[model samples]
Structure formats: structure tokens, C-alpha cells
Target: MQLIRSILAAPLLRSRIASIAQLRRTFSSSTSVSARAFKYVVSRRVKQKPAKKTNFWVKQHLKTGRRIKYPPYPYGDSNIFKRSNRGLFGGKFPMQGHSVSSELEKKNLRRWLPNANKTTLYSSVLKKRIRLHVVASVMKTIKKEGGLDNYLTKDKPARIKELGPRGWRLRYAVLLRLKEQEAKRLRGR
Candidate 1:
């Protein structure tokens, strides 16, 4: 309250108030100069911070620093994994198999099941072909489901293993692509 009064009681504000009161007295000499404006100044002493927030403001502030507003790959909103992430932009590239071991695994099983190649799910014997299979399976699933917007990242497994080995493989491939897309979008912006 003391700080509030000091800011409002500045000489500039006091002179402005006095000038307004002088004008009011000139216009209506019958009215007291001590009235209306003095009460208004005391009541509105604190110039509260602006409450209007926009998407642009958030994006602008977040983008000002090296910080990336998007969540790190395979995790939640806050960067609790800051200790673990040493990479450029902090955990953007992802550790080996982290995406699969983390979130998005269950999403693959639930959304990609209809079109996924069950045989190539974990075929380490043919690594290249298996990678292709996962990407193809994801594309097929995306097309079958209409588009990528349907796969909500938040719907991933609370316990990752239930996504299964095949689901894990597929999830990693999609996670890579999504990371690439995000990088490109940020660069473009």
C-alpha cells in the first residue's frame, strides 16, 4: 500500500490532478474543488497490470529467449528433464529410443493398428525395411483416420510397456517425423 501511494503521489500525477480540478472549478464554480477527482485518484492509486493476454504475446515472450515453447520430445509441458537434456534447444533431438520408451507408444497401437504391418513391427533382421514399414504403417493409419490431427499426444500411455514392442517401434518413427516438422516450423517462423 505504501509503494502504491508513492507511485500515484508523484509530483507529475499531483499536478495533473490539480489541473483537472482547476478546470472543473472554472466550469462549475458552485462545486467544491476538493470533491470527485480526489476520491477517484485515491481509489485508483494502483495502475494494475494489464490483464489482456494473447497467443501472440505468449509466443513472442517465449521465442525471445533460446527457449522452445513446445514440450520436449516424449514428455510433459515443463522441462523437469532439464538435467537430462544437454542437446541444442534442450532435448529437441531426443536420446536413442527415448520417444518409444516414453510417450506416444500407446497412440501408435490404438491409432496405427488397423494399417500397421504386424510382421515388420520388430524385425531387427531387416532394420531398413522395418523402418520403412513403421513409416508406411503410420502414413497408412493417418490416411485411414483422415489426418495427423486426430492423434492427440496427451492420450499416450501412463505405463509405456502396454504399447507393446511393435507399437514402440512405430511410435519412434512418428516421433522423429514430428520433431522434424516442429523444427522446420520454428525455423520458418
Candidate 2:
């Protein structure tokens, strides 16, 4: 009777051990899965650097190496009273704190002023006031050449040589400008 009971107990003990082993395997797998998910969440929550804001004026100044000063007045200031002097001449004349001739010389204004109309001059002034160096340079070149037609017809090779390898780019831009101006004029009429 004792031997039979011992044999039965041994098989029962083996079965119990197998069940415990299965439980341990299941628990370990579940814990490992949870640990991996926790690690993923922690990685995702890590702080990132904020994006920097670029100022147009500063960028233009840097690119062109020009000293583009801000206007004396604030952005929202009323130009009604000040318009009499500044508006008539388009502020191209000398003022209390600003010298138009000096500004023009600094920006190489002679290249464009001969061909510029009131509209063109006004637009150029706006660009300069805003400190857009790239547009200002393009405007000056385009105006100096007296439109795309003149540039293309006058001397293709000579102009190209004078402008170096990138002359084609300037020609393309001038052509686009001409088309845009023509479209605008047609619309206005």
C-alpha cells in the first residue's frame, strides 16, 4: 500500500512541476512584451529641439553683404502727415536721417534708374525698404538692360560674355518679368 501511494505521488509531483514551468514561461513572455512596449514609449517621449525662425531682412543682408538699415518710423506709423515730403519725391531725395544718394550709390542705383518709371521706381523703393537684396539686384539688372527684347536683340553673345556663364539665367528671368508686365498692362487696360 505504501509503495503504491509513493508511485502515485511521484507522477502527481511531476505534473505539478510541468504546470509551474508553463506558468513561468507565460509570465516571462508577457513581462518581456510589456517591457519592450514601455521602452518604445520612453523613446517616443524624448524631447526634440525647436525649429528656428528666419528673418527675411537678415537673410538678404547676409547673402548680399549690404547694409540695409530699417526705416526711421515704426511699421504701423501713419504716413499721412509725412507723405507730403516723402510721397511727392518717392523719398528719393535727402531726408533728415537718410541720404537717398548715398543709399542709391550703396545699392548701385545708376544701373536701373535711367529706365525706371514711376511704377518701377515705386516697386524698387518698396523692395529696398523691405531689405530684399536679391530682388533689388535683379530689378536693377533688368531695368539697366532696358527689358528682355533689348537685351536679346542688341547683343546676345556680348551680353552673355559680360554676364559670364549665368547670363542665360538672367535672360530667362527678364523674359518672365516682361511677360508678367505685359499681362498686368493688358489687364489694367
Candidate 3:
């Protein structure tokens, strides 16, 4: 019985060495493959070059009378190729500061008072305290003339209203005319 047990243990120990040798044959090689192997093995993974991004805005928006490539936009963007903008209410210019409530009257008003002295004009704006739009137009003109800061600064706000309402209305009118002139200027540009 002892001899049989010894014989069984010897076979088991021998199988353990054979198993280790089998593992070494399968996975234990640390030696790097020779560079010469690459000569025969063609690289299957061709370097996948990246696709380029397209810049198509200029071609898309060229000012031509051809059929449009995109849908119309409700808001006019300088870059977009679109038609008239849509609004819930009609007859109102989408641009601010122009009131179409009484277009003809407004046009006449522009003719009636074309110029108001800047000093007196700015003061009237402070007084009528009309809608902020009137003030904004005057400020816009002053800015265009490169003298808004000179005419009215935070420190001079009080002196503005002392100029009176008539003066302010006249200033507002002059601003409207100036804007019209500027519009013509831009159209020519």
C-alpha cells in the first residue's frame, strides 16, 4: 500500500512540472519579436486620416436671386439668406426708435424741426422726459458725432432737464433727421 501511494504521488508531482512547462510554452515569452517580423506582416490597420470640417457660410449666403437653399428666418441676421421678417403685429418696423403709429405725421415732424442746438437740445430731452427712445436717439447721434460724453456725462444729468421740453422735442427731431441722413449714408456705403 505504501509503495502504491508513493507511485501515485510521483506521477502527480511530474504532472505539475509538465503543466508549468505547458504554461511557459503558451505565455511566458518576454523576448520582443524581431523587427524583421514586421517586414512580412503587412499592417492591416491603415492610419485612419481625420475628415476635414467644411466652411459653407459665404457660399450659402451670397446675395443672388436664385432659389434659396435654406428655410426663411423670422429674425433677420446679416449672415442668413432669408426674406422679410415675420412679426405678430404688422406695420411696425422691427428696428427700435422708429414708431410707425403715425408714420406720415412722424415724417412731417422730421421736416418741421430739423435742427436743435446741441446744448439746448440735450437739456430739453432731460425735461420732456419723453419715452427713453427719444433720449436714446439723441444719445446715439451724439455718439456718432463722437461728442456724447462731452455733451452729457453722469455729473451733468441735472443740468439736462433745465433746458425745457420744447428744446428737448427739437433735439429729438434733429436726432431723427441725423439718423435719416445716416441711413442714406449707409445705403450709399
Candidate 4:
């Protein structure tokens, strides 16, 4: 019975020792592989080629000389480069500012203002002229009425009395449009 017990213990100890040795060998080999991989990565990054400088004249020459060939046109002798007589916004002038409300009033105000060169005047200049006039007039009216808060509380009749009939109408329209824009902004529109 003692001999059998010793034999069994010997085999178990040998197996345990063999497993420990295998584990150590595996761990050592994995660490070496990792070290080699890190070195390879570092060496590869260091050995990267420097970027070549491009000549501007050479680039320009290449661009100008290289014309892409297109298939021949089936239709004979059409002038593809001719400018069309059509204007933007279907021949009507485009509105200048971001404010979408009171467009008609803006257009009327623009027409009322005199232009230095009517034929050559741009829509932007016209819009700016109208905007300047409206802002100045409204500011004058506000100042005359004391303040904005006071102006708001006053009745329409009293406000009209402060500014003349035509002046009051224009100021009222401008202020109303401005208020609409502010309300739109507040509502996240």
C-alpha cells in the first residue's frame, strides 16, 4: 500500500512540474514577440519617406495642357457659349434682406427713394437705401415719443399725433414688421 501511494504522488508532481515549465516557455516567447513587434513599428515609422516638393510652374503647365477629349456633338454648329438674355428671379429683382414680412412696403419704399443711376443700381443698394430711411424715420419717431416702452403704451391716435399722418403710417409699418420678426425668432422659427 505504501509503494502504490508513492508511485501515484510521483506522477502527479511530475505532471505539475511539466505544466509550469510549458507555461514559463509560452510567457517568455509571447513577451519576446511583443518586444519585436514594438521595435518593428518604431523602425517603420522612423523610416517613412520625406514628402516631395511640388513645383508651381510644373503643376500649372500640366493642368493647362491636359484637356479632356469629349465625344463629337451630333448637332451641327451650335453656339454653346452664348449668354442668355434671361435675368435672375424670372426678370424681376430679388428681395435683399432676410426679413420676409413687409416685403411690399420695402418695395414701395425702394421705389420712393431716388437713385443716382437707376439702370445700374443694384438690388442690394436699393434695399439698403430703403432700410436706412425706415430705421432713421422710426428712430426719430421713437425719440419724439420719449422711449420705446412709452411709445408702446400710447394709443394709436396719440402716436399718430407725434408723427404726421404719412410718417406715422410708414413708422407703424416698419415697427410692426420688426415686431413680427422678433416674435418669429422667439418662437424658434
What lDDT does the true structure give each of the candidates?
0.40, 0.40, 0.38, 0.37
Candidate 1 lDDT, 27-145, residue by residue in tens: 66677867657544554467789876532212232234542243324543325424222211211222332224255554222121222232322222112223222334345544574
> Residue-wise lDDT of candidate 4 within 113-168, one digit each (tens)?
21212121112211212211223444544468574434433555644343332233
TM per candidate comes to 0.22, 0.22, 0.19, 0.20
Query: What is candidate 1's CA lDDT for residue 183?
Result: 92
Candidate 1 regions exceeding 4 Å error are 1-154, 158-162
Measured by TM-score, how close is model 1 to the native structure? 0.22
Q: Candidates 2 and 4: which is better by lDDT?
A: 2
**How does candidate 2 score on lDDT?**
0.40
Selected candidate, larger TM-score, 1 vs 3: 1
Candidate 2, 1-189: lDDT as tens digits: 998778658977879878888888754544655355454444346688798654333333423576444333222232433322212121122223322465455432232221213332322211222211123333555568674335432454544433322223333334445566688899999
Candidate 2, residue 30: the lDDT equals 44
Per-model tally of clashing residue pairs:
0, 0, 1, 0
